[model samples]
Target chain A: MKLLRIYRALLTAQLQATAQYRAQAFLYVLFSVIRPIVFLAAWVAVANARGGSVGSFDVADFAGYFIALTLVSHLCMSWFAWEFEQDVAQGNLSPRLLRPLHPIHYAAAANISYKIVTSIGLLPILLLVAVSFHARFQTTLEHLLLFIPSMILAAVLSFLFDWVQASTAFWITRSSQVSFVLGRVSFIFGGQIAPLALLPGVLGTIAYALPFGYMLAVPADILRGGVDPARGLLLVGAQALWVLLFYAALQRVWRAGVREYSAVGA
Target chain B: MNAPVFVRDLAKSYRVHEREEGLGAAMRALVKRRYRDVRAVDGITFEIGEGEVVGFLGPNGAGKTTTLKMLAGLLYPTSGEATVLGHTPWLRESRFLTQITLLMGNRSQLVWDIPAADSFRVLQQIYEIGESDYRVRLDELSDLLDLGPLLHKPVRQLSLGERMKVEFAASLVHAPRVIFLDEPTIGLDVTAQTRIRRFVADYNRRTGATILLTSHYMDDVVALCRRVLVIHHGKLLYDGGLADLATRMAPYKLVVVTLADGASPRFDEFGEVVASEEGRTTVRVPRESAAERTAAIIRAFEQQVVDLSVEDPPIEEVIDRVFSGERPLSQVRS
Candidate 1:
């Protein structure tokens, strides 16, 4: 209960601060939509060139997949690797450590709040793309019901995984190269740039078994009308499993990293 | 009865990597690393009762800040046992964390881009304070610190003193029982320092909050703390009342004599001459022998002496002498 209230307050503050800079806020949200839209257009052109289908996905299907991918990507993204580096360099992290609450909670809240605001801006663009491309998605009550839960679980897994990665700041002075490599790997395997089913044979098999696909493609698949009862249940289970695994990793890294932090000032 | 903050043989040491200064050395360090042990807080022990304001005093690199970090639960001690309000600080349980606040002078925990009051709201949630309680505490703090106008200003827009005032209010909005302040008044102007000092004193008096403060400014120590613990080179030097420290380290009074004419006078028989001008002489006289020395000086210049006065040595001088470890009380008396 306390954590919830703290998150709400932090979210409110972040939104208000973002609102204060109207032009910058608008540009940020617009840029967020533009990136996925460009990706969607490029993939749609590819599907058209292939006579409107690629691995069982037509142009409409590509539209729905990319729209959902954008939303899921926004939910799962983590900037703390960069944020923590700056904080460590400027000695800002020291004050956070002195506070009562774990600093990760604040970071998580800020990330979620920014996503919520950005999603609001994304709604119109997503609707426009869906209507123009005639995207065919299963809008049944059952699919909607499962979609909500899947999105939530996907967010949890993403946050936990990003937190474990950010905790590396305590051990290394610079983790940007490591984070960059991890992000690139996730991009290829997580199905952010392409659907997992369309990947070459071996890569497709690897993506199905890894955590990255569960973070991006699973939720997108659910939104694109690909989740039957069995598959929906299986996707939810995978998300929960990843959440637990990543949470354990977060704990392990936090415990050992703090022990080595030295709390030294720059 | 107030609870005791107990620390048993606290020690904190770090293994810092060492590298020579050169491109070749840097390249070599990339392949082979060497480290040296730095004992930041070495085997020091002290205790404070609830509501007691204790000052941690030391020169730069004396481990004052490091010890405070341990007490505040920010850093794990290399080896030792410490408990704040009956709970090991490093465990940092939520219940314990909710009841404590730590403030650093150079750091502001409040959100930089927003008004300080907004930061208070976030802290309120973190502490789970009821709306009524939050408002009451905010009002009280605003009235005490005169934070009404400053509360709405972005923290970055405020001056150092103004920002510190807001920072102080933000830390206390939860009404923490134990406050750890590290140089809270550092880098502030004299008037601002006095204001902050008074606020701290009043806060302690009203709420009976236990305060452990570390500062390099002796005036801060003298103004807010009755008891001070001095450390140097990571070792505890003295832990006692301010007056006791002064008396223990310095046993002499400074005497200044004024003469009527612009002529140098011989007064070596009275005491050691610290300074002499055309018409005045300043001397350091043993505390016990102040009266005798004054009388002898008066007799020597019965017609020439215009005015004379005596006062205790400044605390800064006494501190310097204590840290040097050479100015013994007996030596000063003799």
Candidate 2:
């Protein structure tokens, strides 16, 4: 109950901070679409050039996959690692550390509030992209039901994944550079640039082996009608397992990292 | 001093990776890097009775902040035992944190671009202060710090002093029992500094909260703390009364004499002339002979010695002497 109150207050403050920097928030949501659109345009052009189809995907199918990837990517985005890097670098963590709450609450609230504020702009822009591209988001009630759990698990898993990276700030200064590479790897393996089915053999195997695909592509794949119900259940289980694994990793890493905290600038 | 803010052999040393400049050295450093242990706060210990507003005096990088960080549970001490309000600080149990506050003058908890009142609300929630109690404390602190006008203003809109005033309000909303203040008055104007010092002293008086404060500003120390712990280069050089500090570091006093006549009898026979200007001369005389020197100067100048008084050298000079090792730790009797 107390944690809930703390989360509420922090979320309010974060929302206000986001509101204050309207341009920055707009740019943040704006940039989320840029990558998916680039991929959509490229794949759709290829499909069109090949007489309107490439293997299992038509031009409309390419549009649907990347568009769904963009929306799901928005849900899975967790930049707490970058924020943690700044907090440690600026000695901002010192004040937060003295508080009774774990510093994670601050980042968690900020993450949610950023999405809430940016989603207002992003939802419309994504709708416009979908309309412009004639995106075919083919799905059924079962897929939608399965997507609900899959995306939630994916979001929680991504946060834990980023949190593990953020925990490195406890020992390594300017850890954001390393954190950025991990984020890029997620885009590569999480079906952001290409559909999971389209990923060449070894890359596909590697993506599924790692937690990144479950963190992103699994839910989008479910939403885009690419998976059977049995496979979707299995994928959701994999996401939950990944969430639990990353969560455990974060707990140990965060504890050790905090132990190594230099309390810089204080 | 049972259950007081206790400490025993507290120390914090950091293993800092070292590397040299130049591409060759950087390349070599990639394969093999050197390391050095910096004892930011070496083994030093002191106890403070509850309600004792003790000043931590030291020059920059004198382990003051490191010790405070350790005590506040922001940094784990390399080796030591410390308890504030009967709980180990470094463990940072929620109950322990609830009872203490660490305020850094250079750092802020207030969210920028938002009214300080909003940030205060967050603090209240974070501290789990009861709604009624939070309201009462907010009113009391706001009234005490004259934060009525500033609380509604965005933190970025407020002046540094105003922001500090709000910072104090935000930090104190929970009414922490042990306050670790690191340079809380830094960058504030004199009026703001005075107000904050008075607020701190008043807060301690009202609540009997133990306060350990570190500041380069001696006025802050002199105004609020009668007992001061002087740490130098990670060592506790002096731990005693502020008055005793002056006596220990500076065994001499200054005798300021106003000469009615521009030309005066040579005062060097009395002591060293520390300063002379505008028909006034100040001499540094041994503490023991200060009274006698004043009497002798009055007699020698006769009616020419218009006015004269004997006083200790400014506290800044005494503190400077302490830090500069004029009175080494071996000599400090504290």
Candidate 3:
């Protein structure tokens, strides 16, 4: 309860600070939308070339998948990796370490505040795109309900997973290179480049095997509806497992990272 | 445990990567980097009774800040132990943290883009300050620090001195009982520095907070700290009253004599002439012989000698000599 209050206060401060950059926030949301739209347009062109259908997707299905991808991507996003690198390098982490709370609370609050403030603009833009593209999304009450826990679990899992990667800044000077490479890896294997089902051969298998797929593609796939019941259960279970794993991993990494911090200098 | 702060042989060392300045050396370092251990805080120990403000004096890279960081729980000690308010500092329990604060002049805990009050609210939550207590404490701090006019301004918009005042209020919102201040007056104008020093003295008196402060300015030390811990190269060289440090490090006493007229009385024979003028002359004499020399000079020029006063060299000079290794550690360690 105390931690929640702290988070709320921190979140409030973050909101007020971020609100000053409303134009920049809108621009950032616009830029975030461009990627999915580009993917949607290219996939639509590919489907039209093949008699208006490819595998299990047509123009409308492609639009639905990509639009859902946009919303799902926004739901679980965080930026502590880049920020953490600067904090570690510039010794800004010193002030944070002085606080009673773990520094992660600050990052988490900032992440949530930025999302909440920007989503006001984001949701409207997404709705306009969905209508313009004639996107079709079908889901049952159960599927829609399942999407909530799955997305929440993915959000927590991906946050910690990325946070663990960012914590490498404590050990190595150029730790961002790890985050940088893993970023592209997550983009490809996490189903941002293409849906896991549409990937050919081993690529699809690799996507499912890695945690990245659960982060983006799995929750998104469930939201698009029409998945085998057993697979949905399996995906949600994997998402929960990843959350626990990263939770434990984050604890260990944070301890060792703090120890490593003393070793380095500050 | 009886003291508010205690440390036993506390030491901190860091293994830093070293590389030579050459493309070839850089490539070689990539394959096999050389590491050097910096004993930033060597085996040093001291205890502060409750409410005692001790000035931590050292030159650049002298481990003052490093020791403060360790005691404040920002860095773990490489070896040894420290207990602040009876809690092991490095453990960083919330109970322990709420009772302490480490303020760095070069760093800030306040959120940059927001008004300091907003940041203070966040801190208040973190420390679990109650509503009434928070309001009362902030009111007091505003009065003490002149923060009323500045609290609503964004931290980035405040002047350096104004920001520092607000910074003081932010760090103290928890009413930390143990405060570690690293160079609290650095980069501030003399008037601002005096205000901060005065505020610290007044705050310490009222709250009985144990403060360990590091500052380059001697005026800060002279004004606020009666007791000082002088360290060099991560080792404690002297720890005692400020006057004692000057006396021990600098073993000479300066005697200034004001003469009425024609008062030249072989001042060179008594000691080195530090300064000379038509009616005044200052001489540096060995500490042991200073009194005798002053008496003899007065007797020789009884009619001419109008006034005489003996004093130790300035504290900065003493500190400089210490850092310059004029006196060996074993000889000067108090």
lDDT of each: 0.82, 0.87, 0.88
lDDT of 1 by residue, A202-257 (tens): 99999988899888888888877766857877888888899999989998998887
In model 1 chain B, where is the ten-residue run with the lowest total lDDT? B325-334
Docking class for model 2 is: high
Q: What is the TM-score of chain A alone in each candidate?
A: 0.93, 0.95, 0.96
Give the candidate number with the greatest TM-score. 3
Candidates 1 and 2, the one with greater lDDT:
2
Fnat of candidates, each listed: 0.62, 0.88, 0.68
Highest DockQ: give the candidate number: 2
> How many residue pairs clash per model?
0, 0, 0
Q: Per-residue lDDT for B46-83 in model 2, tens only?
A: 99997899999889999999999888988888998888
Give me the displacement of residue B110 in model 3, in angstroms: 0.7
lDDT rank, highest first? 3, 2, 1
Q: State the local distance difference test value for candidate 1.
A: 0.82
Interface RMSD of each: 1.9, 1.0, 1.8
- C-alpha positional error of residue B198 in candidate 1 after TM-score superposition, expressed in Å: 1.2
Which one is best on lDDT?
3
Chain B TM-score of candidate 2 stands at 0.95
DockQ of each: 0.59, 0.81, 0.66
